[model samples]
Target: MQRPATTPLSDTAQATGITVTNLTKTFNTDSGLVTAVDNVSLHVPEGSFFTIVGPSGCGKTTILRMLAGLETPTSGTINVSTGSDKPVTNSMVFQGDSLFPWMNVWDNAAYGLKMRNAAKATIREQVGHYLNKTGLTKFAKAYPHQLSGGMRQRVSIARAFANDPDVFYMDEPFSALDEQNKTILQEELLRTWEESRKTVVFITHSVDEAVILGDEVMIMTARPGRVKKVIEVPFERPRSVLELRRQPEYGEIVYDIWASLKDEVVGAAL
Candidate 1:
């Protein structure tokens, strides 16, 4: 929250989970080659909830895309291994509803497991469980278009969790929902996450969301992005967002992040 400090908050844990070193990305545009991220480095421990918050176009999504193997880094290295044989990120939920409109809730939720050729019984069990967890089991037969925006996002979460990937990468998954729906989904996600304790890297613009859901929150600089600082969350698990927000420390943490973000956000806007 002070000047953009280079000294990251200390966590001496050895890096056995996701490790990134000097990660940079650029794109050759009509104007010229543009660097979007610059020499960013960090490490995420396994089974930890790591959240990232940054100004828009600060390469947040670009960084995530590289981690998910959807894009290649221009330079440097990104090593992410969850030991789940299926894939590194069979578990990503985007800000928008990424569900297939043609598929019903059950099929959509079961899609990943089915693609992995999981047994019918296993698919039924996993998909049914996630759907129920997201409060969508009764609407299992409904297509995406037949459901409300929140319901569709529920299906996306259900599908992502049902896949049972070792790591989850969520990019502002509840950004589009109303406050009530977003709150409900946050609770649902925490409940499911507690059950498995899987690793998750979530990207969000909301400081509250980042603090509430993450074990550690990384703040990124403006365009040509870089890691600014890392702060650890002190709250324990099985957290209720509502309850967590009531504490004085929660308000202070949120204020600190937002206070730190003002300058970067201003730069990004220009």
Candidate 2:
């Protein structure tokens, strides 16, 4: 397949600082070609929190993997610009903590900085700053096995933020937590995003979570995933989850996206 031309972001769109153009991916199996993502194009403005949500096997994670450079796309382009002077850096937080078993919380959080040849002082400062922000300061000495699931996830979040990445790609980072823990982490994630002013691309199965966190939500089709629709979330920032839920438009948007998703999900199930 021929690669599509790069789509330039418009002046208005450039404010978000991330552009994904004609992004497609295919996998070759013994059975034949399997297209995971097809002709998907999206623009995420700088400092905006964008989200991709779909049912299982819809290629949401595949799209994120491609952006993280872990998976090569069969075609398309991902353009990310942090600023004029600095190179763009991206950090990913996966579903699992993936922390080293022997490493303490602080060490796990400092691992990236260590790899970058950062000074011990710099690593200490960055790790301390983010761990405090994520409320994991007390657990800084605890091992991954000693911490609760939520605490481990906090360590993951701190570690990602400690890298000072220009963009954050999260793949269901809070899906494993209990309801209360998930809600708390979600709020903390937003607070961190607000403070850092980094672009974010999050993947989730929950419509409520997507609506609560994303400035814009992109729905994907099942199996051979494709962009189904891009919906702008018009709610104001510093949002109150309770208040947002009560808004009439909230239910309307959820229903609209669900309607579009249901058939594809059903078809994939068959």
Using TM-score as the measure, the top candidate is 1
lDDT of 2 at 190: 82
All candidates: TM-score: 0.92, 0.91
lDDT of 1: 0.86
Error of 2 at 151 (Å): 1.1
Residue pairs in steric clash, candidate 2?
A: 15-46, 16-45, 16-46, 17-46
Residue 207 displacement in candidate 1 (angstroms): 0.5
Off by over 4 Å in 1: 1-14, 83-89
- Report how far residue 219 has shifted in candidate 1, in Å: 0.5
Query: Which 10-residue window of candidate 1 scores lowest in summed lDDT?
Result: 1-10
Q: How does model 2 score by TM-score?
A: 0.91
lDDT of 2 by residue, 1-270 (tens): 232233233434453367778988899989999998988888888889999989899899999998887888899887776545456778899888688889999999998888888998889899999999998889899899999999898888888899888889999999999889988899888877788778899999988899989999999988888898999999998877767889999999889888988988888889
Q: Give the per-residue Cα lDDT of candidate 1 at 179.
A: 91
